[model samples]
Target: MTPLRPPRSPLGRRFGHLVGAYGLVALTVLLFLAFSLALPDTFPTLDNVSAVLSNHSVPAVLALGVTLPIATGKFDLSIGYGLGLAHVVTMQLIVAEGWLWPVTCLVVLLGGAVAGTVNGLVVAYARIDSFIATLGTGSVMYAFTGWITDGARIVPGPHGLPAAFTDLYDSRFLGLPVPALYVLALTAVLWVLLERLPLGRYLYVIGSNPRAAELVGIPTRRYVVRAFTGSGLVVGIAGVLLAAQQQIGNPSVGMDYLLPAFVGALLGSTAIRPGRANAPGTLVAVTVLAVGLAGIGQLGAQFWVTPLFNGSTLLIAVGLAGYAARRQLQRRRAQPSRPVPEPPGTAS
Candidate 1:
């Protein structure tokens, strides 16, 4: 019997499969060049690139947080609301109750973890659909934010906060923005966890097939819950960073970030691992969106173009992911099933 093989020559395989995966990256670069050529003096400068990177850091972190739940075929719509509530809680702790910055940050992180635990319990134990569960929870979180803020904004303290705390967003390291460095460090840690650890394997198993994972004695519930907790923790951190950056906390600030964060996650899944939500893919997706939006904005496109671009890219990403999944299934189906060979010396 002949050995089974993948179709397409090596080069063809690389180009065909990887092209869609990296298409957005190439598009980002192309758009950058076009904008640079058109704007000449304004668009392609180092300062502009730095500004884009710094501004995008929080959203990038949120997007990366979303990827873990997504890998397990779940969504956390609560991230935006969670972020709002976290910021509110952090401010209240510091300004109203007179807590120190470190203590307040810890409390906020804990709140996020608790919220995520509720989400995980509903999805994993109650077997509710992730979408509905997160949506309902998200509404509650938003309500909390509004109630806490009294429909108003929370400004910095009288003495403002500690310089060290605010410096998380404001300071520069090695001539690059500090927030960008945070994003890079978080990405590196997560990449190691997702790609090198046993927990990573279990996550992939659960995402691929929960039943199979359970049959193999893996605790799918625990891991799923952990994914949510981790996601929420990261969202909490993002909230803190936002507060520091803006020097104020408004209930409406988080919603604008939601669409772009999801866009980055969806777009990321199409790269790196093609059909998988990997850490590197999520970062690359954010870079592409940041670059594209920066380029478009520099070109004097209408402000609405940013959201329009994100929405369109999200739809295309969904379609591409579906197609890739379907193709994988078809490949599995098309491979010939091996027949049992006749027993040696037992002629019919």
Candidate 2:
């Protein structure tokens, strides 16, 4: 007979869980420290800190947006395209049409919602695979982007974009970049929505098992639609921020963020709440990428290094995420089954 192992103490189990949850966070800190030590002058400076935050905030936001649909076991490949169109439109409205900054932002956000709704409708009602559907939608959005820009960049006039618009991306808040603050606020909101709300639970359930969720009377399709819509809205916000920061809208800028956003979101699944996508985890993942890239750049890495790193990280993250998910499922299977309650008036 196999020897039985001693049961773990509750304290020990809790400690283990804590480490598992925050291990990536710890890794991020370690990477920062190591780089700071290695490149004392540049890596540890406040200027470098601000630059990294300012440069990466948009990608971080996009990563967070992608996390929602991922939490529902879906992907939003069209986010980059949505982002491209949203920002271009923002520029077209504000720079070309002389629309007020506030009005332009609102319209762009609404357009994002509409785009997300179309993606949701196509995926849920049409019963198409999210990967293929989003890709198709994304291509269409890219086409629209091209049409809007006429394959050219949108440069503002001599007066420049409104200060209010540029401030959205350029201003600092309490010594931190405003865009970074936006990322933090968005992360907190998504954390609450995904981890503390019934909506989150419903989405998680659907993600884990659609049939099981349906059997439990959860509206999986509607929730899936909601997930995609939320993603689109967040993408819209990021696009506006991108436009504000770039000041000159490039039709192809959206795709630049795509890889890093996905890399962050996927790698994040293997940390924090392992086997699951969470907002906090996504933030942590983006930090890791940002730090690594900043450090590499400071080390005089080549231009191609960034994409290579992102692509490699993406593949590894996917593998680890899949392995972690399987492990979680196995753990569930290993647990003792609960006894079913006897029906009322049917048993003693």
Candidate 3:
């Protein structure tokens, strides 16, 4: 992981730190190159790239979704269940109830918001641990998911789904997959929100030091709620995209993504802005996962390998995230302290 060399000069020191901060991006490039070189006939093709982007885009969205809750130092374990519920609900409305796709999407998004609100309320007001609360809510969501589809897949009508609807996922914008564009757009929005916006600043403050944030007049509870709500909304977006992309409602598919999303979010906190969850960092982490998985799958990895990879990565991500946080704290402690000025009257 120490890919960059430490330099003695001041400017070189800064450059080295910068390189360390964004090493994941460099790893992404190296990974892509390695796979391309290793699987010359398959991995280098545009079709392969397009397929990977299209397939992993939903998971990327989910990871981005989870990043919000994590920012507030709260985990929304319900997102996977929320995604499944949203997916099934989308298809059920469209196919069973004969609702228009636009309306269905809107309703589902709103439902997602409501679900998030519930999570926020439970954790913020009820004093439930976010982990336990979200897990319980997620299970309820899954039960509703099964109830909606009766544990059966929701297939489209004889005419299939509306072309315009499927086009949400299937269409290309300038020869690139549209879902990939969604990830980029969401990333930019989150980057602006978390890195540049006051609201995001409040959440980060709350995450790093809740009592300090409250003493400074930030509404820590409200912001934490907002964080989970945002995560829920993103989960809905992913679900909508999943329905469009899949064109079938598989009641159990949502759990498949839970690991990778967490993996991406946790591992992401170790890069770009180490010790803090960030949009660009999450994207870089997801890219690494996508590339590595694709390369291995192409090399004839068995079906179980995907889960194994995700599971192992999740463990590593958790460990690295803990280490990064401690390292950051140590760095702060090691910094030279500035002298404080005395009160004018007292000094006189």
Candidate 4:
């Protein structure tokens, strides 16, 4: 008699599924290797890695922040403009008004929160679509930025700023750069919040189905508003960091970061959870872009290539996410409506 074949265990199946979900990471690694091989000493150096991390940190943070709103089924296009305005406010407070850096940071953060609140109200109470709401607000914020700076960069002297303040961007920790550490720490905190917390569950539930969440007494409105507010607060922090790193607040700077931030968030949805915007997924996506862009830049690629890469990645990621979601829905619909029949004469 032929030997009986053993059934695959549930754990093995789950492990395979997990591996399949993270295939993007493997692709990212392969791309990194390709670039490393092409650029040799230039692309794979520690200094290059540090520069990529430092340059990408602000966008990574903003991407993570934007993930919350996206997860809750809303978009905040205002983040770029908010960053521009917030940075200007921070610089004006410190250089023009002579306020302390700490106080200026606090006030700018609060201003961002206010902007987010306005966005939330427009979406939740005014019954406007999130994209439209944020676009309108973002335009207003851009105008404010222009008015504040008069379309010029605000440069501050290093005199009144504390070393610790500048060190937030400049210093290194444990042989790694400070901005990289900040990204890692922020990723950890956000990962825990999205993966382990009750609020996280609520956010997901609302994102998946707001009406159902509301019917179940989940306070969907409150959570949605909170997500935007939290996103704004994070953008505010990023703006402060950007000011520190650049030592100038230019009206044109913030929009340059927006494409990468959205690309990161959208690409994140196609990995890890395969249709959900999660924190760790965003980190991986950001890492992929950072590595890719840094490598390309090191190769002396034209500046336009960066946007081309980001745009293509964003489209592909969104397409993959949509396909995955459709497959999930189909599987759910095709699930067996009744239990399979046991052997003849088994218990009825």
| Model 4 per-residue lDDT tens digits across residues 1-348 | 999978669898687567647877987899889998998888878888888899999999999989999988899999999988888888888788888788888998898888888888888778799999999999999999999999998877757456667887999999898988888898888888888877777887778778877766677777788888988988998999988888777987888888889989978877787677888888989999999888888788998998899899888878876776665556557676432223223355
Candidate 2 ranges with C-alpha deviation above 4 Å: 1-12, 335-348
Rank ordering of all candidates by TM-score, starting from the highest: 2, 3, 1, 4
**Considering summed lDDT, which 10 consecutive residues are worst modelled in model 3?**
339-348
Clashes of 2: 0
Selected candidate, larger TM-score, 2 vs 4: 2
Strongest candidate by lDDT: 2
Q: Where is model 1 poorest over a 10-residue stretch in terms of lDDT?
A: 337-346
Estimated TM-score per prediction? 0.90, 0.93, 0.92, 0.89
Q: Which ten residues in a row have the lowest lDDT in candidate 4?
A: 337-346
- Evaluate candidate 1 by giving its C-alpha RMSD to the native, one decimal: 6.9
> Model 2, 1-348: lDDT tens per residue?
999999889899789778767888999999999999999999999999999999999999999999989988999999999999999999999989999999999989989988998999999999999999999999999999999999999999999999988999999989998988999999999999998877888887788889977776777889899999999999999989999999988999898899899999999888889888989999999999999999999999999999999999999999988987887787668898443223223436
> What is the C-alpha lDDT profile of model 1 across 193-281, one tens digit per residue?
78887776778668877897777677789889989988888998888888778777788888888888888888888776777677888
User: Alpha-carbon error at 11 in model 2, in Å?
Assistant: 5.9
Q: Candidate 4: deviation at residue 268, Å?
A: 0.7
Ranking by lDDT: 2, 3, 4, 1
Error of 1 at 8 (Å): 1.6
Residue 285 CA error for candidate 1 (Å)? 0.8
Residue 14's C-alpha lDDT in candidate 1? 77
